[model samples]
Target chain A: MRRAGVLALVVTTLAVAAALDTPAASAAASRLAWLVPVALGAVTLGTRPGALVALLAVSFRAPDILAGVERDGLTAVTFDAAGDAVVLLAAAVMTGSLAAAARLQRRRYEALGAVQRVLAIEAPLERTLRRVIACLDWRLGCAALTLTLRDGDAVATASAGCSALAASGNRDPVTREVLRSGRIVYLADAGGQPRPRRVLGAPLTAAGVTIGALVAERTGELSPPERETLVMLAAHVGLGLENARLAAMNRRAASELDTKIAAATHRLAEADRAKSAIVALASHELRTPLAALLGFSELLATLDFARDEVRRLAGIVRRETARLARLVDDVLDLSRIERGLPVPLGPRRVAVAAALEAAVEIFAGVDADGTGRRFAIECEAALPRVVADPDALDRIVKNLIANAVKYSPPGSPVGITARAVEGAVEVTVADAGRGIAPEARARVFEPYYRAPDVVRGVPGTGLGLAVVKALVEAHGGTITLDSAPGAGTRVTFRLPIAREASSAAPVD
Target chain B: MLAALGALAGAAAVLGGHGLLPPRAAALIAVAAMNAAFIATALAWAGAPGAGAVAAGLVLAASGAAAGHPAGAIAYLALPAWLASLARGGRLVGLGLGARPPAPALLAGAALGVGLIAHLALTVSRTRGYGFALGPPSVVLSSLAYDVGVNVPCAECFLRGALFNRAQRRWSLHGAMALAVALGLARYLADPLLPHASEVLAGAVFYVALLGMGNCWLFWRWGSLVPGTLSGILLFEGYRLLVVS
Candidate 1:
């Protein structure tokens, strides 16, 4: 509507100028009416449009000037006519320049407002920057604008305008200089060709740290006020960008906190579930030995037996008692582990071969009973003594032998190997049974956990490996399990040699 | 080389214009030599295929001028040359032989032509009245035909296209533009057809400098010869309005 009003005013002014400059009114020399449209256009529209209107006004006097030239000698009349045109053009240009400056000031205000609006909204940093630059391209009327920010060690650039013009704006030397000097850099257009006439850059400083640059390339030189507005705009945008960055950082931090909380909650739930399972399993395991002890006592109290029978019954009672003691010890150790207490260890330099042989001798009876399960023990000669608890080492070897025996098929043999290797004593137990499934391998050492399918009728509680693992770790040793569903199972444990106490040479 | 040629061309034209030399023979030699020089230089620098076609337009213009029939066959030669230029598949685009002078530049060119003509109409109206309606349509068309077909292309392609682009690489873009504008100024002042009067030459210097700089600016900004060519055509068409005779 404003544009239409301006157009109407220009047209009305031109019509009046035309009517007044007519032959009916006066001679062409006395006519000064044509200056009306020139002045109006200049005050209203600005330089180029006003100049065009001035051109039109001059054309209006052309015929009169030619007629004047015919009556009077051509030179004087043409000179007068041309002189009038210059006056009209000069008036338009002068007024137009002032009008242009006012218009530019208004535009810069609007551009800053638009940039601030975008910065006010909650949006991604890059998106906000792009919108700000787009406003400069539109409202501030730059040929190209680029906002470059430092993203850690990399730069994030958002550009607006012709791709050919703005694509390299981030890399422009003016932008680099602005960022380096932390001051405004102005590159005036040099060539007469129409390119970005002025490249103005201001460093985007946030919290006294120079982050990057805000660059604008324009086709015309800016007024002082417009330049001031640009400096102020850059500062506002710098703070906006930094604020956006901090907001984004906070968002990421909150997301990570949520994930960790969820993970910790899951762990707590898992621990509660394990506690319930441990109680159920402990009661079930204790019932077997307690029922045996009750039945043996009942037999002695209710029945009269011969002398040989009484002796055998007594031996049976003694063995069950010992078995019950071992089970109770395992339960106590598991409870200690659940409470997060370190295992009690009496570390001493112990012979690796002697410990392995002693643990295997206990499993020898199963091999002797014509159970196709067999033990093949191999100990390296002159094996180094390891700095480990003698009891923990024995327990580690026994637990591994038991796991091998349980997993081995009737016809398969369990192999045990102990050797001094690379400043440590290494022991391995192998079995060729159905083996553990890869999925269950991780949880096999966890208390009361077992592979469901493979351990269908397998005896004994699942505390064996867990207790062995805790004891071995307490003695400064490492244990590993390698198993597959069909490919058998292997467990290896290594303890560091007691180099300070003894050498790697055989102590045998 | 361009500075020297522009100076030599200006000297020959000034001498011929004042009757110090034969105008017809001087213009003929200058036209032939300028065209030949452009062709040789283009062939030497990049062996541009468009050079061959544009040079044909130039030589035909030279020959037509010698025969006093500049508007005859030479005017129509722009057709085949423009087609051949299109068929070269954008290789010449880099050499400023293509035609994409953007919307803004085209508008600026038209405005520039109008501005220069307005200035001419204001300053030179006493001595040389605007000959627009006084001359035959054929005369105006003939002059415009020469500009469109031969003069605009050869001059724009050789001087602004090749020379300005090369100098921009070696020197500052502003310095190169200034150099191109200078050579363009010299070329115009040296034309035998330019009026042989001090007042007329003074106006010519002012207007030609503007035209030269404007054309160089058009070529540089858009990297196209089309805007300058259109402006050249309009400029010469306006030139035909002058009643120097």
Candidate 2:
């Protein structure tokens, strides 16, 4: 629209100058006024067109110059005409140069605005790519435009204004050169069937990686502004592509966050439910033993009872109190471990054989009924002493022996074995009893998790194995349990040998 | 105890001179009384020392204004009170001096409309032969400077910042709004230009009261004195532009 206004202005100015050139209307002052339109034309239309208008104005003044020659002389008329020509040419040159500079600045501003608009588009990458291609095609007057994104061993192409120019393979020579050199490449003519007369390729790089290429084709050599604009457009396209990728990643992260929140909420609810169950069960378990102790104590205080009855009730109270103490201790131990407090470890060199014998002796003393529960101990002679916390080791061995005896049937044998192997001490506890179910074996070491089948028959807090596992791991050891329903269970653990033992041994 | 003294001073200013007191004196009395009410309410409800200091500041400003002090002198009189209040180390929200996320577009549109209406009203008064003209450049400049630097801040701080916030907490919203209206109308009681019981007097009172209520609502909504002060300055400048002669 602006270009047409300038054209109309140029035409009107020329016609007015021509009308004023008539012999009846001729005046020297009016002739001088003709310079105004010539200057205007130069500023609006630039050097060449402005010079043409100036020439036309000079021609229109020829008749007056002839008349001047008649009135004065040829020499004077020649001087006047030469001076007029010089003034007109000067106006054209100066105004034309200024106009060209202004045009270049305006084009740069427009290019920046277009790039901003392209970059501001918040859409999927494919949609943004198509919009950018369309913008470039319209702004640069490209016959066709294509953007090729390189994925691993694959290329995805988006085209505007031409489908035949779509990339047929993972590579195009122009695009390849631009991507490899990280520079703009131009082809005078695309040398292929249905080729464009000119093509420009620029690498779309982001974060030091050439993610894609922008290719534009037209039917003539691109001007410098056009080439520069294409380069600017390619840079904006790279940024827009990066933004799209980041947006996609953000969306994925949000979805993942939602999933994690849901899972955490579920786990919290499950924990709350488990806590309620533990409270109910623990209260019932405590109340039952308390009722017996209270009832028997009340009878002893208020009524005369036989000596045998008194002794039996006293024994029952003693057992119940011991059970309550054990339960409290287990609860406190697990709480301390979960709170991440440091567990005390008194490290010293201790013989594994002596630890085993001591645990077995304690077990024998505790088996007051003496239903023939037996332990088979096997230890390698001359085994190097392991550096350990003695009390912790004693707890580990005693807990294993107690578990074995508690789970096995009366008269069944429990086995304890220890040996030094490959810079470590390995221990195994085997029991012939109703083994843990395959599904329950994995969870036996979980705090407060009792086997459903044995919980009703056995008197235990389900913390024995959990405590065992924790102590073993705290001492830089690994523990594993192998068991199946109706099959005997085997528990094995290994602890690294004391550093001094390994260092002191001579090389064989 | 300070609030009681401020209230007594306000009562003396309003009731002592009967109909002979100047309009400015009556306005100062109303400002002092409102400040006293606010301080009493805040002390009873929250025991906030900031409220006491703000009340003291308003009383000082009233005293200065009653003595025909310049706007800058009055502001200086109020500065110590503001400092004392700030040193109490409590949230300023209870005093309506904090920002809330009110709709910006709505506030801006309302401010523009209020400015235009004020200008139009002054122009109409000029056309009605009330003698309005653009004054000398000095008069215009001084009026703008005083409105921005003193009058808008003082009026907004007393009415919306302290009184409205305390009233809202002490009474129901409607009751608080009623208190604001009553205090606003009291400013016109001693004006000699509009004689007592005249229709013009009643109209002025109603208009001023409405302005006060609207600004209080703005303060409550935005939880800040800023919008009210900004609107007050705009209206003051517009009125000055139209009728400063």
Candidate 3:
């Protein structure tokens, strides 16, 4: 309201001075006239609302001058009043131009803010284009806004806010000129029809390429600066649209990764099922062959072959056949033990001294072979009578002795000792060989596991210790091993005394 | 009706032992002879489905009678149904070995006894008077002293408790009945007519010694007894300690 009052007074003073024909006749008003416009113009120099008020006041004064001439004869007016009218018209033009510039500058700032908000809300290219077209209609006072983007060679309409421009396929001199020159083009007022008053066009350039054209229509005449604001807004919309397109592509790539992971998981489950079936079938097939080997070996041993050579051959056959039986039994026993089945147990009254002697005799024959590992047996005659399964005891002794002989180098003495302690018969088996490393000792009793440094083609199934530990524990005995790398191994087990059967006091 | 109540109480005890019974049902059975009231209603409500369906009508009557209020009846019945449904959907079916029908009767009896005792234990920590014991010496009465100065345990010293089952898998009932008889007879045979009689019973001792020895043998033969063999041994030992010690 203050801007309007200042603008009105300036226009009146300028017009009165301009109506005078001679500069001398209007000189006083003209000098004052300069001050009035300068102050009003300065108040709204960079602001649209203030500049608009100045333009309106200047335009209003022009009408009054024209009305005065029509109402009264031109002869009645002074020469200076006519001269002042000419100067007032000139001043109005300057004020109107300033107001239009400020209005255009303000519109561009508002359009930039609106475009940023749209990009923030919607990230897809097609959606951003749709919003750009809608904002041009609402904010720029355009009757129609059409966007035609180049997708490969063909230029096609991507989105449109106005129905009429979209129906016409958007091909016009203005659009073609902007696309070809990659610059802004404006058509003003369309010869005062008001219906097709103005059209402004600008090329949407992104990454140094002319990608598309943005065209807006105005129902009223547009000044030079109004046309410039439309063109700048068009470029900002193009940049926002490009960012959205790249984001969509990234989302598509992430979806493909999820699909591949699901496929791989399905394949792994199928492989696991196939492996379980193979183990079941193979174990079932081995059973029959093992039974045949044991059957024939028993028959051959009973034959009583005449010559000593024949009998020796029979003994070798029995030994070899027994090895085959052991392999199959180990496989079945490992599976059963892992499945949590209990191992059978037997108890007998055994002389502790005799058991040690028997174990030494068994290992003595094996040590005599080319391996040349020596055997030593130490027994305390006063060792208590142990109630244990003799058959299980023999397996424990044999496994430990055989393991020692197999692992140690020639000339390393394998030691065995027995004693009575804590109302129990305790036996110890020690072997001087490449001892088990600490890291590997924890896994030595796990069926089928072998250390990394062990000979890759070794014969044993790695089930010996597991079986020995199980059998000993079933007879109420505890076994422990002590070993270190290169120091050799010592294993000991203790069997409880037969309390019910023995009434005699401890020999110790 | 009383016989039925007794059977149900036995069933509750078994379930409590295995931890199979729903908490609400266990609590109800633990309240004095609360199951006796339910058995009476079940009998009165049987063959009278039009009165409201046998199970529903009996539950309604029993809950009201046992709890002595309508609101309490709603609580007792509704809580069990809700809790049972929650358990049945997952943990009860997945983890509990005693949920199967064959074990329910045994589990039920044990559950009732243990739950009641446990509830009482929580409230009265020092009293253990209601607990039962079984085993030959603890359950039987006898007089015998060893002239050889060897420790001769009294029959009643070993008695923890007795297990009675009418349905024990088809023909196995005969063997179970015979075992119970032999165990009972051994209790009476502990008293000697003369000093030499103690020495003469050595063969009998050897024969009966097979009982303890055979149990240990089976433990070795079978890797794992589903539901665990240790639980039974602990239950027996606990009873022995309670009475004899």
Candidate 4:
């Protein structure tokens, strides 16, 4: 581009030199030669270069045009030479002006496209604001820029190539005025002043309401067209900021959805594990009793025997049949518990010692396998009467004693202790039996859960302890188990003490 | 808007030149029509539909009266002296009649008004042939009554009471104040009394804008129109004492 300007300069200078050297008649024709360089420079190089060439042409042509004027007061040749000079200058100016306007229009469209590209994507607010500043600095040639937005009651600021605080903190009075007045404020220092800059501040408005402000500083005069561009850009910037905030909100909602899905997957994995353990324990415990009842009844029906032999076989069949019924009942209760149904209860005040003795007697007789169980019962004197259904409390105690008797060796004493502690009646059943491992302690209350090493040898369903825990909790009480493998297990439960004996109403 | 003002001013000049009316009466009618133009615009902007007819009647009355009977020419002056009666509990009280403005606000307004008058009186321009208008005490007092009673209340009604009240809801305090100042300058532009010289016109703009901005602040700070009206009365009274024509 500079090379074109230099070529224009040489041609324009040569044209003037020719006009000065030629005769008066021919010099007028030569003066028009400068038009060629002006037209070519404007088309190829740009506006300023073409206009500069015009000034140089007119200056070189000046002397010849004036020489005739001093010799002969206003001759026609001088008038003709001057008219040609005017036409040359006018041509240069007109071409340059048109070129300058076209260049400005293209720059404006490019700047708008740059701003729209940053706003089209959903991005963070800080990223969006930084791009806005970068867009103005790169496209508008702003030496410094500051964008301030109102975040609730506070102002949030972004700066490019300038101190954010200086512009936002009233270092530029025009910025404050623009924010307060919602108008464009322009300030240009006089030309003679040192380090002069033009500062422009415009309101950033959304929906005809001002939400923030933008300030731009550059080393030039503020053109009316640039001011208009700022006004339109400010509106786009406000909407861009709103879009960024929405993106942040969407990200948070997505994160919450991911967390919920993870929780549901974990619950499903736990349920699958529980189902596998139930299948293994239930098949063995149910089949053992069924095989015993089937063999004894078949033997009695098929063979003729003495009366005593027949009676003994009949006793074996009745014992196995009863065990089968118990197992079926336990399976039904476990199913109901797994479905999250609350245990039904009927409540009345019952003497704590009396309830324990009755539960003990029920289990003290010969077991279903014709095995006798040794038991011990201990109660603190003056133990408070507890508000409970007599039948539910009896079943709770019976389940715990039964779990201990099943796990204990033959004739091992199962101890039952009852006392009033912390405004409640506490009962504990302990057995000197093969104890539960520490790993299985946490899930002992879970229905149908059994130790992998212990369930194959045990001759009962793994539902006794879980049923006892639920029945205790339904009476507004708590139950805890303490055990270690190869040691012994102790299960304790507490129910709130009754205010008056037998005064509590029945369960709903 | 400028074309509308130019048309009204040009109408009087053409009428006077064609001897359709005596020159002084025509000039008086033209000034009245210019003043009425501002009033008509304000009323119409406020959604009152009858402003144009009222403005026309005012000009017609000014046209019929002779120049020597200045009061007769502006016979509307008779009602201005009592217009203060409507100001105390005005019908427009529904629009931001805030707590009674503190006494200090009135004092500050008077000080500003006095200060503005001091600047105008001390800086009389010789090149523009501008100075204080002189007349008998009766004429001066009558004009002062019009300034205090009619003009102050009317300007306060539209600029601070109507426009500022609505604009502040959508703009910042300074934004609303700036609009009042800009509208005040436009009102001067439509007036025939505004001088044609560029420097005098600039000075008039500076003072009018300053007065308008200050009055907007006064009303916005207290949410009431009384202090601004008081300041306006003082400023225009001062303006009357220092007029060029």
Candidate 5:
């Protein structure tokens, strides 16, 4: 309404100016004050309005032309009026075209700005796509807008201001063309079922890859600015889609990181709990023997006892001190292995039979006081030598024999067996004693873990089996425990046979 | 007492100087407030700084907000509360800055319902037109940024963080809530356009009071400023779109 009022006012001013200038204007100078309305109309409105103004300006000169014809002649007035009309018309057309182009440029600027706004919203891909379609439809004044994205072999379509594209049954030719050419395609009179009068399609490309196409449909042919707007919208849609994909990937990565962190936290907590339990148990174990040793030695020192009594008290102290010493040595050895400190091993050919016999002699001497425990030795002829540290070999044999004698019934025969099996030497120490329960077997190798039933009345640190397993693995050998309750126990191990040197004789 | 006085002085300075200062100076003040609050919060959390020092930091932050950075005001206000909670061996939730899941869910639903209803009323009254005109993208983006960053955070800080939390500490919960409602209404009353006639005054008071009380209740029930802030933002944005344009 305001625009119409302004146009009317301009026309009235032009009419008044033309009437005032017509009479005073010389024949040489054509009265062209009428061109003002034409130029103004063309710049403010479009070509049609500007043309109407030019016609009005030419008609307003009719009265002047008639007066001129009465006073002068027909040829001069006709030429003057005709010349002014032509100039006005030409100016109107030129200015109108420039105005139309400027308007389109302004619209294009607005369209780009709107696309930027749509992209700024950090929404999911589907939501962002829907918003982008809405934005394009509103900004371009289109009847309908659609976004079709390529999903592998299939196309996923989303639309605004219209029903969805006829599902998979109907293919859109414009969309297909845009996707194929990777360029903008405009369709005039898009003639298909559910056809639009006009359609503009632009390819949505991201990082140099043609991902999809954006299509806008309208009831009339799109202006050049509208088509350019569609192109800009498509570019931003491609960028928005990439951003959405990156956000989803980041979310997935964060979720995985959270899971891993939770798992690590749980493991650390469990380890801490186990360490605390071990510390508590170790303190109790150490204090009990130390208490006994101190009490007995104090009693032997302060009290004047009879000869026999003194001997008994002194013996008790000796046993407790030995137990304490053994506990300390076991702890030190386990710590060394755990810390990855090398244990001194003198690798040499050691006769297994000689080590076993010596171990048996030591066992017999310890039990010589009274408790009758018998040992039976069995060895295959030409038994092979083993490559081992001699002292370690001696300790291994002694520990096994001691365990066998301790667990067996009085007078039970503990067997020591050695046999050559393929390239390895096998040794077994069997005792007619209580065997380990199945449930406790797997965990027996864990440090400080003791079987409740086995530890009752047994004065042995639970570190023995744990240390044995570590030592065997250190030598690249393996050990196995075969036992059942009331059926006795058998411990077997295999060590690779020592390779003979070319210049050295085999030890028998 | 000194911390409270400092806070009051800072708030007065910001409110007084807001319209008087040039845009560039206001912006600088806002940035300085944000940085001061951030640094103070970090130090308090990492090294257990004294309460006096934390309070002083918050005072500086409040002055910054007064200088026209509403978002910075929220951070500055929140830092002091967080520091106080830490000194007391309490949690942020205890001071109404964090929410449990169920509370937030319930509050969100309530906020949405209220916002929608208010928006519809405003639209029917023709207070403003629907705001979704095809405008320059820059204007739209800037408006949204102002909504989320400046308006929402600043309002939440004033009502929930500084006003409600401080009142609750000094008085009973109900008393603190009454004070918050009064303050909220006082803000609306301060607007020059509000009808001064008695008949219009009652209705205006009732409307502003209800909004204020509802927001305060949301803060208290959820044990956080988040729900209340979100509710305020949703309602404000909805109103802007449907009515004020």
Candidate 6:
């Protein structure tokens, strides 16, 4: 609006000045006098207006000045006319310069606005690239853009206006120059069969490393200034491209890692199945030998009364062999349970208190001399009968009680408790001794895994807890440990009470 | 005494700002000294050296206002120094005496100086329209001189020192430089096409928005926004001032 007003005022003032300076009014330059007032009016309006008025005034005086020179034969009037021309030219240049400056400023603000939009919203990488490309294209008057980036040796990737352009690979020279010199490259034209008329290439370098080249293509030619501008634009474009690429690479890596972890998990599950099978086979194979060893040891014990000294030696051998047979039996049982092999179990409705007493009776004769451990059973009188495999149940209870007695400190009491809990029998065997560490607690139930805090040289097989855990679970029960280092250890197992006698029996 | 001290500080600030002294250290010291003087002599009236402080303040405010364009206003502020020589009864005459040869010469000289500065700024602004536009011939030359002779190298030092900071994290000098270059380029490409006061103002607002948005993305994905943001600010402003000023 200001420009328009100024231009209007200039044109009007010049028109008025030309009228006053017309040849007819020259003789009456003093008489015509209205031109001065008009000129003053134009100045008040604005410079453009004043200049316009002056221009008109001079144009009007031009003919008179020319006529006077012709008639009077003097160059003074012609010189005066030329002076007016010079003033008008000066005014025109000033207006033109201001207009150009205004245009430049407007461009700058528009660019800022575009950048603002880029920053204001969350956009995908592709969208950002497009926006950046559009911004550069709009400002530089370039038709197409190509950003070629080096990965290791060759161009890692190239973003181009047309995929076909990328296919042609005209950007190699620019890329090579940037890669070699690590400097911006400007080309007036790509001198090839299918060359772009004007090309501006700048190295997209970060940390003094020339990572890529940004090339802007134009149809005609670029001025030196325009070329320089393109190089700068390319540099910025390179940055945007690098950001996008890095984001993409990171995303790709994350996805790849996720897939790898999934594959690893599947392989681990397969390995677990294999281990279970191995344990089952080993246990089944050892059962026969274990039974034979037990029979021989019992037979030898009976024939041990020939002589006092010989008898005592035979008793020692018999005890050691019996212990070895028991160890083998425990391993076979643990392996069978782990592999889900059917065991000969008879289910019957039995009183929970009777079962606890029976397990205690079986362990009463065990050597607890060194430990001085005593066993006690505390069963609620009102505890309901639980239907289970009596032999398996007895073995589970006996194993827990024996372990407690064997491992507890001397003079400590091994407590056995049985109670009715939510339609189930809850039994716990607790021992006062060195406790299991938090790290080893989970592994203690696994075959051959013993708590490190247990004395290194102990008598029992480490499969005790493994067999206990399996037998408990087979009866639709759960076993867990409540123990910490130095606080002693308590192992608890819960078995569901059978609703009917038939429910306790396993189906074929 | 405080008032006198403040006057000295004020003088130092002017010298620092005007490049008569090294800008970085001088700027820091001058700022501290002037602020202290302002507080210490807070109750002092405008008399004796106090007047000089007031004058210095006015100059500073004017120069700061014209920071991006360091011509018109800065030169106008300096013009009075030459006029002081022609003082008559503590006031200089204009029209008759002002139009005298000597006075015109002084005014012409001042105008030329201002015009030259404005021209230089415009040229720089044109050349440096994008991140650190310091890559341009003009900037590279000036930076070289500064690094070799003045040895201040504030920007370079900042970049190098900042690498050691854990809080500054994302340790890519290349990425920083790239961001700088992008913003600078954006400004340059933007300015000529949208050349207008309203447009320039709008552009500035938009540029800031871009920086903020880009930084936010960096922060969200990488958990660090400072590097991207710092580079953007430095490059954008540097480009605007140097190439497009």
Per-prediction TM-score, chain B alone? 0.76, 0.58, 0.19, 0.70, 0.52, 0.24
Query: How close is every model to the real structure, measured as TM-score?
Result: 0.60, 0.42, 0.31, 0.51, 0.39, 0.35
Q: Give interface RMSD (Å), model 6.
A: 26.6
Between candidates 2 and 5, name the one with more favorable lDDT: 2
TM-score of 4: 0.51
State which candidate has the highest TM-score.
1
lDDT at A143, model 5? 65
Q: Which residue ranges in model 3 land beyond 4 Å of their true spot?
A: A1-96, A123-125, A152-196, A265-508, B1-245
Residue A109, model 3: Cα distance from true site in angstroms: 1.8
What TM-score quantifies how close candidate 5 is to the native fold?
0.39
Please state the Cα-based DockQ of model 3 relative to the true two-chain complex. 0.00
> Which residues of candidate 2, in runs, are more than 4 Å off?
A1-197, A202-212, A218-236, A284-319, A347-391, A401-413, A432-442, A450-462, A485-488, A495-508, B1-245
lDDT of each: 0.70, 0.66, 0.52, 0.68, 0.64, 0.53
> Which has the higher TM-score value, candidate number 5 or candidate number 6?
5
**Clash count list over all predictions:** 2, 0, 54, 1, 3, 43
The numbered model that scores best in lDDT is: 1
Lowest summed lDDT window (length 10), candidate 4 chain A:
A188-197
RMSD after CA superposition, every candidate: 9.2, 32.8, 49.9, 17.0, 32.9, 26.0
Cα interface RMSD of each candidate: 8.1, 34.4, 52.9, 19.8, 31.4, 26.6
Compared with the true structure, what per-residue lDDT tens digits does model 4 show for residues A109-217? 7877887787776665667778778887777777678887776677777778753325445565666787789888866531211123556788887667677888887
Tell me how far the alpha carbon of residue A3 in candidate 4 is from the true structure, in angstroms, after superposition.
7.3
The sequence of per-residue lDDT tens digits that candidate 2 reaches over residues B1-245 is: 65565565566565656765675566555545544454444433334565555545565554455346444333433533452355345444444443343678347536743844453454345333233467776566656654554455555555666666556544444566678667656644543323464433533553455467667666545555666766766766665665423
Real contacts recovered, all predictions: 0.03, 0.00, 0.00, 0.00, 0.00, 0.00
